[model samples]
Target: MVEPTGYDLLLKGGRVICPATGVDGIRDVGVRGGRIAAVADAILPTSAAQTVDVSGKLVLPGLIDTHGHIYQYVTGRFGLDPDMVGVRSGVTTVVDQGGPSCMTLPGFRHFIAERSETNVLCFLSAYLVGGLEGHFYPNLYSPDGVDIDATVRSAVANRDLVRGIKGHAEIGGFARWGIKVMEMAAEIARRAEIPLYVHFGQLWGLPESGANGEDADTILERVIPLLKEGDVLAHPFTRHPGGFVNAEGELHHVLQAAIDRGLTVDVGHGSHFSYRLAKMALAAGVVPHTLGADMHGYNTQVPEIPAPAGTPEEHADDENHPFKGQARFSLTQAMSSMMTLGLPLDYVVKMVTTHPAKMLGMEDSLGSLAVGRVADVSVLDDVRGRFVLRDNEDYRVIAERLLQPAFCLRAGKRFDADSPILPQAIAA
Candidate 1:
């Protein structure tokens, strides 16, 4: 007869991978009162009220998506529901990239973060307009639109939710404001004493008169100096201009120096991702630290907006928009892309877990299954077979292993990976 043990739940026989604790084997995790109570080779089923057999599945610390855009409704159609991309997609924590400005952060905290099941945080936008219409209006993002003092105050006051600052560094912005916007953003980040996450690919359309002496290849060189240690350079493998790959088809010479200067990289794997550029960067020894799906309503399938007569939507076709009919995406899909690029599975796992935790400065509370920590765990199905992986450029590769989210426990509450936007793999 087994003595009564006080575990509320026991996850038995799962291949647990917690890089932070250096555990990568079969283990039984015991949870009590929403925290990890024990992790051992054997935790008797009778010791817990509920025992979940997770055999043949990969159990890991819950995923942390570092570049989510889940402001919802307020950011127009661009924002997604917090839970849709959060716990429902097997991600325990999501850091919304540039969704809430200092002015709109209060609503984001009350409506999105406070009420959500998953942990929601933000890299507060430098622009006062925030992510309105998906940053569609490029005119609103000029330096004049940024209030450095107010933004700094908001970030300081809401240190609990605002982890960093978000700004852009692409050619379009450079041509318009000539790096003044970045200068202001850097100042705000400095005052707040948090990292600044800068977008490094083409976002806004360039000025009608052209670059006006602005060069895409030189954007990184100019922007890197303004950034300090712990600051992030996002979208290194972007298909768009002003990324790690220069116009000459070679990796930028400044990339190594930037990384050496304690600057980190994030694979903001959005529609801008390019398999070709990713390969070039990998060959050039530029590996990103964190991976985020960067999913929003525009990239994935969402309700079609009823536009006014003769708008771009009326004439849009698949040819004009290459990614229109592509497969849906998630953080798991981003991990698979890295795996296909020849990165080790464990390394890819670290990108979504430990690396993101460090990026958010919440390593102690998030990203690990250490005993006494919150019971945030992810269960993934590591399906081994030939599957087709495609990028924004429509480039495809055959991958032998694909990781799919089975479920996740967020603060001890279970949520299945049932988001409609979860990708369905095509046979190779």
Candidate 2:
């Protein structure tokens, strides 16, 4: 009898790591019609149409960034293209964090999401007014903007693309208004049976006032009670007055209590989330349940720092300082940071891939390389070197470097890195 036809593409001789299964052995991955057909000790060269040898390199599941803001791309900033920043950097899925809301979802659905090569998901902002508005406060607090009924309608209408609800509850800036607004969002999420993604503030406090008012402890106290098991506490490591660290420079019990109660903690490493807090939390054994770039146009520039005096009005884009230029931390950079904190590579990989997928309730369909799963794959050149990984202007040592994607397969088709794709592919 004739042997069955082999796969369309085969990745050969790489150390395949499946964090879900705790498998980290050299293996070959076979792909057919954009699905992972097989992973084995070795697949003969002749069993596939094309083969790329990835000898001596580490192969893990394509990363899934749980937080980011890609809407800034439409406004002209330097954020890396989602596909390039993601697929090329070994990240296959990206959740656009609160970039779009009810009013702007259509634009995102058409202009950004449809045209991108990356697999993009969205966490709809609780505010109907969208993040790109001119006001410092998002319109969500406005009666017209905070219409939970409408938000729910929109979420249900676009259930396939809308993953959950997102809101930023910063203490001094918008916490007072945001608390009520997010409550509405939570109600809507509950009705829709979706998770709620909250960016809890550190500077703003409970009564919601003070220079370092909102501490992480207080924020967690109020927010944790409102959240269900699957709800996310994004940016759990920011070093603001109420962040992971207390005034005494110790890990706060409140933060630990929330985690213990099943609140999923995500390191949404944006412009403001503090590296100090991240280091402390890691040291305290608080591993981030997920990792995201929080990438926005301004935040995409590598080595992003404080803006010089009097540049332009456009710079005032996101009140959040870190999203102003290319973020200091890329998705891979975030993973590297976790590795430096003593997390094994497999565990770190899970935080970005499987964990986020499970958090979003898309695990069976998206995160793993199981047979019949979507053919989303990223290949990397594991460049060996020692380097520093920085976040929000703080630096840490990374003993190795992971080169960007050599090739990406999205939905069973190879994305041509050289194709006249707009927004040039970002270097890995």
Candidate 3:
């Protein structure tokens, strides 16, 4: 009898951790024609066209970044290239939250989503104008800016790419016109029959607020009623006002109620993340359901971060190559931060995989290692050493176990971790 052809690519003897299947073992994963063909104890090297020895690495489902911006040339200063944060960064899927509005959906489909190697999904911005310029124009985020009929229509038309609706329930907009904007956004989401991905916390610079003089402390009281089950509340760990931590430095009592109502708390880990605040929440036993690295050109590709302040180094020369740019990172760094905060490796892996996939409503097909599933996998180099991690608030934590992306397979195709956005190893 003739021998049957084997898998196209095989990952051998890696510590596979699939949150969906509760798999934490050394196994061989075989890929065939962009789908997972088999996962077992052993697959002979000759049984595949390319067999990679991943014995010491941590192999898991490809990461699902629940939040980021990558509309590229269209969003200009706010956007980064899709692939820069996607396949190259070991993230198989990335949800571009609020990057494209209803009007820009078609352009986004052709220009950004279809062209990239990484899979791009969108939480369509509720505004008809979309996330143009990152809402720099505060007036655009006002209630009047959201066109209910148009936004809903666009979402339905692009249902394949549109996973949910995007809205910004920030202090500036609430202050400007109260919850009128949020209500409109909520209505748009309702009509579209999708969840609303709401961006919370402060929207403006310090001490400035709504024209009606609504304070940040009242944000939850005002916005919570508008959120239904499946709604996403982002930026729980932000240092800014209007986030999970109240102005009095206490976790908001309403957080539990929102969770009970089935709302998802996504840690939109961005330039505003605060370790001090995050630790407080963890102490209160409130953990985010998902993690979204709010990476963008503004934070990652250098919108400018003044050099860190420290005591003078007497011996350093110009060749020392002083780190002058901002401390930007990908999903791997965010996962490391969660690990540093005491989340177990398996739990952290779930947050990036199962949790996010379920939240994005792609749970059935994504976020697993089941045979016949899309072969999207992430290979991580688990390094043990003193690694310094800093949050946006300048708070630091030294983590002994850090996960660095070595590469990723998007639909069974390989993409190396050569993106400039990957965080560099910080010497302890």
Candidate 4:
């Protein structure tokens, strides 16, 4: 009798949904040698060394987070552990948004990316300071602080890890330095030939002298022309100024035009999210292409890590400060938020999987469950119940269904989804 050539592991009888590959149905996934061996309607249980029944669960291409701040210890108290926000949270890949600059890329690569079980990537900071203390000091992010040539060189030199360029076009920056900083960021992204991811909410406090004749409502128009087709406009539903909505509470007309011009949108859903604003934007047909949890220390209830000596202390009285030390959130919760806002489950899945892969320009390797691809899969419990979801502003909505991560496979290795930061579903 001949021995059966079998897989190393198999996930059996799960509702597999791979949007990029156009597959949505019950399937069995076989993994061997750290790649997808097969995804068929049914593979005999005997065909694998080990098999786990996943009936009534969702099996998808591993989730990818487009915005994360995981430069732990180096960025004061603002960064979280990569694995805490990655595989342990049922996400396979995390793109650290603006955490590493040219000066810090080497440390980021060696200490953060290589040492972690989860796959880590970066959006090189356009500024030299590079997410220091979550970009807290307004003076450090000025136009004069950007070294375009150095940033471009760093991005090009580290193409394997750096996917895009991260910068801001918010009201505070506009009031401080006008559009010079954005122009420099655009130039760096252009030179590197990668997508530019721009934040569109208030990141810095305004100058004491006020708006300086620069209006928050007009910031998008000025920045849009500077951005190329593949550039990203993030924080569409931010409660802060300089987001997708204009001063009159209407969706900015220029937003549709930016989309028409091939620009992408990302829901940098953090403490910035507002359900009311999300509804308005969705009603105006401005769906985001990608969804990111934007998890960092300030907005999450992380184990307290004392800031390094001489590090700037967090001032508690800032009126615009996000709720600190009290909330638990994850990318799965962001997906639930979209569903609560009436986006179909399939579309929401795409926002975290396929769409994010495309945004990272990693289509061939990361987005699909096609055979021969890396065996990075996410298994989720598709719970059906009445759950109450809330946002930063304390607005609430009831959702009939919620998707929670169960576990994930990264390069065929299993990681249980058990991050302490994962939010519990409050019964409605």
Alpha-carbon runs more than 4 Å astray in model 3: 1-5, 206-211, 303-325
What does candidate 1 score on TM?
Answer: 0.95
TM-score of every model?
0.95, 0.84, 0.92, 0.96
lDDT tens digits by residue: candidate 3, 192-281: 989998887876433243246778888876788888899988898888788888989998898898899899888888777888999998
lDDT of 2 by residue, 288-378 (tens): 7888866554545532333334434564434544344333446765665666567787787788778998988888777676767887766
lDDT of 4 by residue, 2-51 (tens): 73469999999999999988999999999998999999999999988999
How many backbone clashes can be found in candidate 1? 0
> If both were scored by lDDT, which would come out higher, candidate 1 or candidate 2?
1
| The 10-residue segment with the lowest total lDDT in model 4 | 316-325
Compare candidates 3 and 4 on lDDT and give the better one. 4
Model 4 residue pairs with clashes = none
Query: With candidate 3 superimposed using the best TM-score fit, by how many Å does residue 366's alpha carbon deviate from the native?
Result: 1.0
CA lDDT of each candidate?
A: 0.89, 0.67, 0.84, 0.89
* Order of quality (lDDT): 4, 1, 3, 2
Q: In candidate 2, residue 278 scores what lDDT?
A: 73
